[model samples]
Target chain A: MSAPDLADLIENLRRFADDRDWGRFHTPKNLAMALTGEVGELVAELQWLTPRESAAVMDDPEAGARVRAEIGDVMIYLTRLADVLGVDLIQAAQEKLADAALRYPAP
Target chain B: MSAPDLADLIENLRRFADDRDWGRFHTPKNLAMALTGEVGELVAELQWLTPRESAAVMDDPEAGARVRAEIGDVMIYLTRLADVLGVDLIQAAQEKLADAALRYPAP
Candidate 1:
């Protein structure tokens, strides 16, 4: 299967929300909060691991699954928020990268 | 220009970090922490706004720009973390969404 893109995820999320009558709960503020919660979950997965251990997290099947799930949750909420706000995720990211180039120039 | 995909962002981020000699700092823990920080910033943008107000936030150019930038930062860090961990982000998200569908069935 072809890799899913941001637009595809947004569409799937919209349908998921629609199916569950979740639109009312998907406001920008709420989505942002959900995104935060997901990111926290993701961080908790690696919080106590040493850098080397953290890098090797995916070597363990169970822990790797949990970490992957959390990453998915974070992206789902983030993409949902951008969708509600009419922000193009890729465009926003591209612009931010461009802006960062100036702020942190290569030595 | 054509829309940028997740791989493109990952490649660009890799180059960005490489150019600035910042890979040493892009550990899974560090990237996850950065993701949390960016999510915090995104949440702060909507923290005090009412539902209706939060929905209308993007109507204000200044607030919209900040919100967009925060979203960008969140994605950038997230993509970076996933990359460092050697996780396929699109696959992770797809699997999680599939799992969530089973958990949150339509009524």
Candidate 2:
């Protein structure tokens, strides 16, 4: 099946917040902070794993599911922050990549 | 300026990895683990902030820049992981939202 479009996801998130009267709480600053918190939680999941063990996390079905959900959390908050700030997530990412290409060009 | 397109970001990351011969180290599992580590770093930036304080992190220019960069790191790893696994990050995010809408419907 095809993947969902970023625009649609943003719209859905917008509606979700609006419906819950959450927009007032979703200012760019608030969302950014929330995004970091979610990222922290995601990291907490692997806090004690050795690099090799961390790398093998998905080998465990339960751990894998939790990891995916945390990823989903990160993405959700990220999208919300971008949307609130009028930043196009995709475009910003592309620009960052362009910058990276210059900073770390092919040998 | 328009934000980056997710697909383009993935392509750039793929090229970055191929150029550095980093693909051998970027399996989905490895990427997932690395993603978590980056998230950890992102979290460390705000570990001491109360929720109210956390919500205002971007008020400090230096702190804001650091936060944004960490976010960029998170996005880069996320894009790479999705690319490696043939998952469409945007689409998967949309699907996750669709599920969330049901799980946390409007009141």
Candidate 3:
């Protein structure tokens, strides 16, 4: 199955917020805070593992599931924050990637 | 112009790593740590301001640029992490969102 695109995800999240009457609470500041919290959850999943082990985390079903869920959470909040700010998430990413390429040229 | 999609972003990031021969360092753990650092930068942009100020951050051209770039960095690293872990970013997000919807039903 084709996964949801960024626009679809944004629309889905909008509907989710609307359903709960949460649009008022979804300010950029709050969404950023929530994004931070999700990032923490994502990090917690990898915090204690050795480099090799962490690299292979998905080999273990349980830990892998947790990591996936956390990544999902991170993406969701980040998308919402960008949406609220009227930033095109993919465009922003492309611009930053271009800038990084110049700063750190291939040698 | 259409912005780059997730696959394009992932491919671009892979090329960035390949060009610098940095693929070896891009373990899931390293990516996660890098993701956390980027998230920290994103948070710093919004951290000290009052809620109202933070909500209106994008109104200031300078702060808005910073926030946009930080969001880009976070997305880039998160995308990389998901790629390295063999997780489909959108699919993972869809799953987590579904779970959240079930847990947080409309009242």
Docking class of 3: medium
Q: Give, for candidate 3 chain B, the lowest lDDT window spanning 10 residues.
A: B1-10
Give per-residue CA lDDT, model 1, range A1-107, as digits (tens). Answer: 46676667888889999999999998898888888788889889999999888988999999998998899888888888989999988778878999999988888
lDDT of 3: 0.90
Number of the predicted model whose DockQ against the real structure is largest: 1
For each candidate in the order shown, give its overall lDDT on alpha carbons.
0.88, 0.71, 0.90
User: Which one wins by lDDT: 1 or 3?
Assistant: 3
lDDT of 3 by residue, A2-102 (tens): 65788888999999999999999998878988998998888888889998999989999999999999999999999899988988887888899999989
Model 1 alpha-carbon drift over 4 Å, by segment: none
DockQ, Cα level, model 2 = 0.32
lDDT (Cα, tens digit) per residue for candidate 2, span A1-107 = 25566777888898889998988887555665677676667667777777667667777888767666767777898888766645556655665667777887788
What's the DockQ for every one of the candidates? 0.81, 0.32, 0.79
- Give candidate 1's TM-score: 0.96
Clash pairs detected, candidate 3: none
* Candidate achieving higher lDDT, 2 or 3: 3
List iRMS (one decimal) for every candidate. 1.1, 4.0, 1.0
lDDT for each residue of candidate 2 in B2-106, tens digit (9 for 90 to 100)? 555666677778888899888889865567667777666766877777656656667788886766666677778877876665556665666667788888889
Backbone-clash count (model 3) = 0
